[model samples]
Target: MKRTEAEQFTRRLTHHGEGPVWLGHHGLAVLDMLAGDVVLIDDSGAETRREHLGAVVAALRPRRDGGFVAGLERGFCLLNDRFTVTETVTCWTSPDVRMNEGACDPQGRFWCGSMAYDLTPGAGALWHLDPTGAAVQAIAGIGCSNGLAWTRDGTRGYYVDSLTGRVDILELRPDGAIANRRPFVDVTGEGFPDGIAVDQADGVWLAMFGSGLLLHFDRTGRRDAEIAVPVRQVTACTFAGPDYSELYITTSRYGLTDPEAAAGAVFRARPDVGGFAPYAFSG
Candidate 1:
């Protein structure tokens, strides 16, 4: 498939912009992980406000009752409409490790992963955080856990552990349980996979950090298409717009001697394929 193109959408550049999420009433949001800022972008793709969480904010998802549930440094936090940290849970007591990436399951549970500052081989773990403030360890013994997505049926989950260079499939049970881990896609190459999103057609749009490409893989784990961004540190992406056909992406300028104008700017593209509306965090 031919590569799709995207244009810069935001004026603000992040030092390490990572996760991009679409909230209808809130517009779009992207995080400068290390800077602890949740930057909101308007529908016109303009930077609106910068909400500081004081610690590394890896990812975030909307709460069912409004507000948001976020993956913060070493734990999880609840943010209100004012973007203030209301309730906090310290899942990891270690100062060296911080939240990395995550998303909500179909059951409305927030699942987040963590990694060490030095990127230790097995210092990261994945957890299932309940809205009731329960953080349960789901999977561990991994490295750089990132990019999570689920199938339309909610029976299968896809995940990426950058260290493994493969995307794994998880068995998602109706009772909100995950099991039967197996490799789904082997993206062995120069760069590790960063973030991912799923569309209505079960196509997985994954951001490849070093490759500067967002790969689209079908349910069968075949690379069907790809989108090219102007930056080399593309991080995460999600479907936005009313029909969820617009792909909002995030990138970083963590390590670049000379970067382009779009290095840490948010980008958007109309892939011609609609995306799935993400499940809200019930807890």
Candidate 2:
């Protein structure tokens, strides 16, 4: 099949918009990392400034009660329709930790990982938040945790450890616990794995940050396809649109020069693969 042209979906924002997730028919939720804000963008590409969330807002996942949970550098916050921080969960006992990427499981548990802002090794950990807002550390001893997704069957979880250049898959038990950790994919050379999404066929879509590319992988950890993007820092992606065929990607210009400002834009394309039904909060 002929590859489709990548379409520019959204213009550049003053601060970089990193993490993006689909919120059903509502719109796309984006995190303005540098300005510490959360903005909701509708299908018309108009950004509705929601609230000022301190630190960098890295990722967002919809909640059960019509609100959403946003992952910030220091911790996480809960936002309602009015976009206020109604609840907050601090991830670190020390002051050096910062949260990165996050997603929800089929059972409505919010899973997020944290790392040192400076990319220090062994300075990150993953945590799981139950429906009741109680948080627990699920895994530790990691570097730069980002991009998390689960298999369609809900028996496995996939995640990216960006600094280590590896994606790991874990066996998830019935009680929302994970085990049998192993490397699922290793990205070599330039780019680091940033965000991930699992399709209906159990294929994993990975955004290679700083490389301007999106990668597709089958369940057995084999590269199925790759799509290139104009933006160098492809931060994250999610399946949107009515049929979930539209793949919307978020990019950043955090370390780029002035000439690269336009590089911090969102892009979209429709691949041959279809996405799975996004996990919803059931609390």
Candidates' lDDT values, in order? 0.86, 0.79
Choose the strongest candidate by lDDT.
Answer: 1
lDDT accuracy of residue 199 in candidate 2: 84
Q: What lDDT score goes with residue 239 in model 1?
A: 93
lDDT of 2: 0.79
For each candidate in turn, the TM-score is 0.96, 0.93
List, residue by residue over 37-104, the lDDT tens digit for candidate 1: 99888888777888999779988899999889999898898988788889998887889888898999
Clashes of 2: 0
Q: Please, what are the lDDT tens digits per residue for candidate 2 over residues 1-283?
A: 2334567887875356677777866688777776787777888777765568886776777877788787777677788866777888877666677888888898888888888867889999988778777888888987988889887778788889888788888787777778578999998785888998788888888899888888888889888787788878888888877778888888887767653655766788888877765675544
